[model samples]
Target: MLLPFFQEDLVEAGCDEAGRGCLAGPVFAAAVILPKDFYHPLLNDSKQITEEQRNELRPVIEQRSLAFAVAQLDHKQIDKLNILKASFKAMHLAVKKLQAQPGLLLIDGNRFSPFKRVPHKCIVGGDGKYASIAAASVLAKTYRDDFMKELHNKYPRYNWAQNKGYATKEHQAALDKYGPCRYHRKTFRLDYSQPRLVTMTPSVNSLSLNSEVAVSAE
Candidate 1:
């Protein structure tokens, strides 16, 4: 059972982000401000719910919430700033897009960068603890997943539709076979302690800068 709102006296918005751990695709965030009386038996953390349930809740949330907005930080930005900063940036962008100003923000995670001029509360697993935050989670996850499904058509090798750009074994296999696609983050260690395929030789430490220079000098 989730709490309806933080307090009846203050206007509040819930904040959450999705795809923070994906190897590809954008990180999406959502902010939802629901009425004080908002209630739904099915509402909960997005990860704990099925895709069909999330789809069912999305329209209801959008139609019933006082105000709601979703935003995304693309793959390039995610690589430039790193995942942590990119997640916070997406959340802040969503909050900025809200039609109504909220006095307080209840964020799903245990850490959050405060939105400008608005006070915030960081609740660990707030998505399951608060109705508004749960609603935000549903919106963020569903939207991000839909976006990844669309990207699957452009690059079918990675199987974005199945893994949704996560660091799965099949994804790593694809990376090993074809090298990384344009969406792959250069800064991230693609070979994260995973053994290379038996047929592929590992060149992770074969090249030296001075050796290359000496070869060029020859």
Candidate 2:
């Protein structure tokens, strides 16, 4: 029962980000401009949906939306700007990739870094209240999950495929054993007292994914 548009006459892109709270992997954001008529009974906040439901809705949103783009800011950048600014930069990047310019931006959170000349309205839980924002939430979550799954392949011990880089007990246990990998945000307090576990650094080749630079779901 999300609202179709913030304004009936203007093109509006809903914005949302995922993985801002994770200890590893990139923070992903998405901008979606849906037609005024867009509707689906299953559409809602990404967190409200199951994995299968998110995956199922992803293609439907993409196919139906007027324009949609997903982007990410990696662990390196997150460490540089802090999670809040990084999340905003990721959302800005996603909006930059949109094929059609939006007259207004519907942001899911209470705060956002303004994007260019575009006006924005911040809704604390807009993802559950607006169609385009909910759609953006779905794309952001699913894309970040896929990226984390790929990273899991390279570092199986972290169990990223299962934990999706969250600070789960198993993930904390792995950090307690092997230390942080290149994929981990060093800024995060991992709470390991062993110097040996803290000494290891990721090799040049270990920073494989260019997720820190830019990621796009086109």
Candidate 3:
């Protein structure tokens, strides 16, 4: 069960970002100030929920929240500033767009770039524990997913509609075939330290191991 607010005494906005680990597309963030009494059984980390669930929740969150806003930083920005700073910038932009000015921020990660003079607290996996953060996570993930799906039409080889721009083997295979698109982060190392996004041959056994290893490493 997710709680409504991090603190009862102060106005608080929950913040989260999506697509931070993707090799392509924009990193999106959301800030949501929900009523202290808000409750929803379906709410959890965006990653734990399905697309239909997130789509269903998005409208409800927008209509019911005290205030909410979503923002994104594109691949060029992520490549230029690096994913961490770009994610922070997206969060900052989301917070700035909120209709309600929160007295405090509850960010859903272990690290955060402070937003203005507002105080903040970072809680790892906070989205699964807090209502506002979960809502923000849902919004950010759904919005970014929608963007990727749109991009997929223009670049069908990446299969972004299915993989959502993550460095999946199929996506890497596409990279091997067609090379990195303009949407890919050129600065990100496809092999973790190569400083280039290039095709890597996967051994038959490694093909099965890749998903497990990637998830664990992430």
Candidate 4:
């Protein structure tokens, strides 16, 4: 039931980002400009669908969309700019790479740093409300998941393939044992003292200046 466009007369690109809540890996964003007639029953918010569904939609969105691009900001940049700015920066990078210029940007959050000359409309849950934004969500999540799976090959103990770098109990257990690798966001509050694991000890206090649980608005 997602709408096709926010403004029918203007060229619109829907923008969204993913991987914000993970303890490791880069944050990814995508911009998608769908055709006037784009339609799919499975097109919806990425969070509401299964991995298989998102993967299935990725290729279809790529081939059917008028223009689409995905981009990411690594942990290093994320630490430097903070995740919020990095997320927006990632979106800007994706938007800039689109083959077709967008007259309007339908962003999937309440706030966004303006992109060049383009105007934007921020909807809190825009991804579920609009087709292009949902398409962008699928692309951003799939691309980030692929990158994390590749990293999992190098460090299987963290189990990036399964956890996808989220602060899950298993992931916390890995951090408790192996500590943060280069992929772990240094600025993220990975407080091991958290009762998330009964055996969890304070391993990250020495690593991060802050030790609070870092929740992501992915």
Model 3 stretches astray by more than 4 angstroms: 191-218
lDDT of each: 0.81, 0.87, 0.81, 0.84
Give per-residue CA lDDT, model 2, range 69-151, as digits (tens): 88888888999999999999989988998888999999998999899999999999999999999999999999889888877
Residue lDDT tens for model 3, 28-86: 88889888988887889999998999999998888889898888887778888999998
lDDT of 3 at 80: 81
Q: Rank the candidates by lDDT, best first.
A: 2, 4, 3, 1
Cα lDDT of model 1 by residue, 1-218, tens digit? 99999877789999998999888777888999999999988899999999999999999999899999888877778888999998898888888888888999999878888788899999998998999999999998998788778767767887988898899999988887777766666667785333342233223222210111110000
Residue-by-residue lDDT tens digits, candidate 4, 102-130:
89999998999999999999999999999
- lDDT accuracy of residue 134 in candidate 4: 96
Q: Residue 109 of model 4: what lDDT?
A: 87
Worst 10 residues of 4 by lDDT: 209-218
Q: How well does candidate 1 match the true structure in TM-score terms?
A: 0.86
Error of 3 at 37 (Å): 1.0
Q: Lowest summed lDDT over 10 consecutive residues: which window, candidate 2? A: 199-208
Candidate 2: list runs displaced more than 4 Å.
194-208, 212-218
Clash count for each candidate, listed in order shown: 0, 0, 0, 0
